[model samples]
Target: MIRDATAFLNRSLAVISGIEVSGLALVFGVLAIFFVLLWLRASGRARLAQRALQTAEADAARLDTVLKVQAEMSGRMQTMAEIIGSRQADLTRALSDRLDGLTTRVGQSILSTTRETKASLSVLAERLAVIDRAQGEIRSLTGEVVKLKDVLANKQTRGAFGEARMQAIIADALPSSVYAFQATLSNGRRPDCLIRMPNGAPGLVVDAKFPLESFTALQQAADGETQAAAATRLRRDMDVHIKAIAEKYLIPGETQDTAFLFVPSETVFAALHEDFDDVVQKAYRLGVVIVSPSLLNLSIQVVQAVLKDARLRASAGRIQAEVRLFGEDLERLDARVTALKGHFAQASRDVDQISVSSDKLQRRGERIAGIEIGEEAGPSEGLKSVAGE
Candidate 1:
């Protein structure tokens, strides 16, 4: 039994050891399984990690390429900024220069306009002053014209004015010696004036009375019938005055052959020529010369010149006579001077002969006085006779 029990214990011990060994083996197997699973998981994780690492390497390469591209773009951008800055500076300077030139031109234009405005104002003021003065002068002239019209309205006043104006013209044109006022002619008729011509005959008579009333009536007549009547009267009046002047003033050997009918106004003379040509022709046939104031003045000047020439001719005769007398006196004076010169020559010759004779007598007396004769020597008879004489 002891042996069986010992064997049983040994068997138990072996079974226990087997069981523990199995458990240990199972644990080891489980550990191995765990280790295997862990190993598998580790392998899967390692494969995923390897893929991720490959992906990271690719991404790093791409990032490095992008950085290189970015660096190049930044360099280009800096260069473009510098070019833009230079362009802006040039534009600013150009605009500033243009503004300065425009300002100067505007200033000069303003000054020119100011000067032109001032000069135009000055000229306008001067013209205004001149216009004012001319207006005043025109007003004064109007007053004088009114007074002259009033003076011409009356017959007596008009006649007197005409006579006075004629007198003034005649006086201004001729010397007083060549003309006479209100002179009587040989026919016992007094004329307004007479102009002395160069001839010794009676002077030219100038009659100033004219038929002005008839002419004025003719001028003022409106209707044809009134004008015709006035013209007839004017012709009749002019014929009567001309016939009277020709009969009274145109005397042969007493006055000029053509007597002057003086019309003081040129308008009257023009009217006679224009409308009264027949009257003028008739007056010419009667030896009557019509004259206006201007014509009369010129005629008087001609008469003055002719009279002066005549006086000069008369004085020439006296001058010739005086020249002849002066020649005779000069000849007589020459003859008297010749006679006196001849007398002076004869007197000089006589004086020379007397001097020669006196010199000879002095020589003889000296010789007689110088002769040293003895006391007893009697003087010569010639010497004694000379001393006694």
Candidate 2:
């Protein structure tokens, strides 16, 4: 626009030179208006450039501040990473230690449980062994009981059993010289045993044969009527046994006034006493005593004591004679000791007299030595003077 305005001004000057002075003022006025327009446009462009420089400087300052903030944030993040790593290492070490402690405790618990289980098994085994031994003992006892039942079932074996038991007791209690088994008496009858009495007394008899059939029936009877009948028979049997023993064994000059009826079983003896008082009284009245094994043992002990006392009394006269001889010898020894004391006293007096004579002789010798050889008396004269004094 400026160049088009300048071209238009040049054309106007040429046109004016040809026309006259009246159009010169109008050309000058148009040139002056064009210069004013050019100055205004230039001033506006200068102001725009100054505003752009100020905006560029503000943007650079903001970018520098952002870079400084990013550097400080990076340093803080590195320090936090180092702290997290150290904490993780510590936590791992603590977890390992806890695992080791738990393992040790579990091992110890397992060992203790194993030892307790073994001890319980050992005790159970010992108890089973003891039970087996008890079973064996029960079996052996059952066999023995069966054998005893067989022995008691027969009549002859039962009577022999009683006789054998009585003989064993007598042999154990008395000496061989004082008793005899199955000895014959003067009446042509043999009793089971005979015991010799001391001091020339008659012998005593013991009879072991008893009426067991009636007693056995009494034991087996179940009803009242049967029991009564069995009891009557038992009493009658006891009376016959008592009379027979008295008549056969009690001879006036050969045996004692009383005899013993030996009952082998203590159970039978106890039953007889409990249920048959009349039978026991009748036997006692007829000079017969009913005795159990224990009672017979006690009677034998008494007899042994009596025999020992009699033997001791028989040796008393010899003991008295020996005591008298000892007294006579003691008197003779005393008399001899008195005579020896008198002899010792006489010997002492004779020794005293001999000492006095020796002293006188010594004094006479001393006197004779005092007399000098020049003017002393003779030794014979000195000796005569000493003897006279």
Candidate 3:
């Protein structure tokens, strides 16, 4: 019984040892499988892990793979989120810049519109004010025109104005000519204006006969009939005025070769040009030239050569008069200057003589002072002391 027990015990012990070895082999096999799965995961071979693994006691392996996949997805999601966030930040910054630019432009437009509106309103108000003032002035001007008509009709008043205006126009145009108003010609009819031309001859006679009534009538004529009558009357009146200017002023053989009929009003000149060009042609043929003040300036230039000589003759007479007076004054001044030079020479000689006398007096005073010193010191005794020393 003891031997049987010992054998059974050895057998049991061996069986237990085999079971423990089998359990250890199984544990080592599971550990080796886990190490392979762990290595595959570490090496980033998830596909190989999937092919090798299943729903066994490999929870950590499967968990490791799931965690790794989750971590990768999280990293990819984080990168995408970072990209989206950066785009959103960039878009926000761009939008903010565009909004800032649009706001500045809108503000500038508003300011410009405000300034323009103010300027336009100010201009409109100023125009309305001007219109109001002008309307008042126009009413006043109409009243003055009636009074002016009476004054203009007076002979002395009209004649004085005509003469004064003609004088000014001639003086402005011709600087060299000797222009005179109401000058008595050789015929003894005092022409309105006389220009002393070159060679001491009368250059041209100017007469100021303004046909204001006829010109005004032509300006105010309503229909063709009135306009034609006014125009005919104006022409006939102008022809009479022209003939009068010629008879009174123009002396064909005596006074001047060509005569000037000065019409001061540009309105008359325009009328003559428009309705009466034929009259202008006829006047020119008759050696009676019509001159506007502006044209008369140029006309004066044309005869300037004649006027220059006349002016030179007058200037020569004036220069001779001045020379005579200047010569007398120069003779008087020359005598005075010569006497003054002599006085200065004599004074210089007297001063030299006084300087010589003063030098002699200084020498004499020095001699006298030396003699007094000698007398106080005993002269011979001093001399002996000097010799002994």
Q: Scored by Cα lDDT, where does model 2 land?
A: 0.82
Per-residue CA lDDT of model 3 for 332-383, tens digit only, reads 9999999999999999999999999898778666654555463667877655
Q: What is the lDDT of residue 74 in candidate 3?
A: 98
lDDT of 1 by residue, 47-158 (tens): 9999999989988988888888888878877877787778778877787777777777777777887788888888888889889988998998899789768877777777
For all candidates in order, the CA lDDT equals 0.83, 0.82, 0.76
Candidate 3: TM-score? 0.42
Reference-based TM-score of each model: 0.46, 0.48, 0.42
Q: Give the lowest summed-lDDT range of ten residues in model 1.
A: 9-18
Which candidate comes out best when scored by TM-score? 2
Query: How many residue pairs in model 1 have overlapping backbones?
Result: 0
Better of 1 and 3 by TM-score: 1
Alpha-carbon shift of residue 82 in model 3 (angstroms)? 93
Please provide, for model 2 over 1-389, each residue's C-alpha lDDT reduced to its tens digit, 9 standing for 90 to 100.
Answer: 97776666554443454764333455766677777777777777777767777777777777777777777777777777777777777777777777777777777777777777778777777778778877877787788568657766777766776777788888998888989989999878999999998888899898988777789899999999999999999999999999999999999988989999998889899999999988999999999999999998888888889888877788778778888888888888888888888888888888888899888878778876766664476767766776676
Enumerate residue pairs that collide in model 3.
198-306
Which segments of candidate 1 are over 4 A away from where they belong? 1-145, 318-389
